[model samples]
Target: MNANIIIECKDLGKQYKTPEGERVIIERMDLAVKENEFVVLFGPGQCGKTTMIRLLSGLEQPDRGAVRINGKRIQGPGPDRGVVYQTISLFPWLTVMGNVEYGPKVRGIAKKERREKAQHYIELVGLKGFENTYPVKLSGGMKQRVGIARAYCNEPVVMFMDEPFGALDAQTRYLMQEELAQIWEKEQRTVIFVTNNIEEALYLADRIIVMRNCPSSIKREYEIDLPRPRNYVDPEFLRLRKEITGIMDKTL
Candidate 1:
């Protein structure tokens, strides 16, 4: 593993036994994510993007090859990696504060220290006044905010997000994108986010890895050099979007 590369996927592959036959998802996928770099895995539906994230984050084992972080092979989930899901999986029984502080609490941090840390993240994710509110009472966007806060509360070395805003309304999705950009700016962490949305990938990723359909592998990689708080209407953004979409279509 390269010292500066925080995450490494070396010829990683995965397959599953289905009634039809053995199903392959990823095959010999090799990639590296640098420290504090926000990388997005973007591709069309059924492209094994989520499966790739699972393998990268140690949620599931790859059939072949290796995944390494910080020069050590990833055997399983650890405190160094945090995941945020598409469904905003917050505990309905726990209030906003409870959810955000859960990780630290379980890690056995002192209550006062954890509470202070959770409160900071709660405010960071814009949930200051709603600490007592449970997931059942919050809106879709707000629930995702709690999910983000919870993920960050652990202070992981890298964050894995799988289409986190996929369930939100269009307006809310855009808003969350901007908010996430701001949050990343404020607290830098290496993030590997999976999405099928080109605009979202363009807006968030320092580098975008476009994947192909099942039996997935990298189709192309784009380095997004746009300024922070990117504009969807900007000419450069639209041009790159069109170019990437055309490439994706060709890949399909």
Candidate 2:
């Protein structure tokens, strides 16, 4: 493994047993993500992008090959990886502070220390004044913010975001994208983000890995060299978007 590569997977494969037959989702996939690099896995629906994230994050075991993190084989979930899902699942009963501090609290960090750390993350995610607010009161975007803060509080070496803004309204989605970019700039982490939206991928990723239709494998990889806070209307951005879209499998 390269010293700069925080996560690497070689010839990884996965399949599920269905009543019809075995369904292969990933095949002969190999990838290496460098430290603090934000990589986006972009592909058509049901192309196994989520499955790739699961395998890399140790949420699901691959049928063949292996995933390594920091030169060690990934056996299962550990503190080094954190995940933010499309649907925000905050503890309804817990306040923003409570939910953000939950991970450290469970790990037995001192209350004062954990709260301070959680407070910092809460502020980082633009939720400073909402410490006592419960999830029920938060708008969809705010809820996701809390979710991000909670994940960041754990100080994971890598963050796996599976279409984290997919559920939001278009305006909210755009806002969240900008906010996420700012957050990443402030505190860098190795992030593997899965998204079907080309604009979102272009805006957030340092590199975009396009996957083939299931049983998915890398179709192509693009290094996005655009300046930060990308404009959707930029000529180069639009050109790349059209080119990538042209190669994607059309969904029925």
Cα lDDT, all candidates? 0.92, 0.94
Candidate 1: C-alpha RMSD after superposition: 1.2
lDDT for residue 213 in candidate 1, whole number 0-100: 77
Model 2 stretches astray by more than 4 angstroms? none
RMSD of 2: 0.8
* 1-252: candidate 2 lDDT, tens digit per residue: 479999999999999999999999897799999999999999999898889989999999999999999889998999889999999888899999999999999999999999999999999999989999989999999999998998899999899999999999999999999999999999998999999999999999999999999988999999999998789899999999999999987553
lDDT of 1 by residue, 5-89 (tens): 9999888999999999999989668899999999999988988988988898898999999899988899899988999998987
What TM-score does candidate 2 get on C-alpha atoms?
0.98
Per-model TM-score on C-alpha atoms: 0.97, 0.98
lDDT of 1: 0.92
Best prediction by lDDT: 2
- Candidate 2 clashing pairs, residues 3+ apart or interchain: none
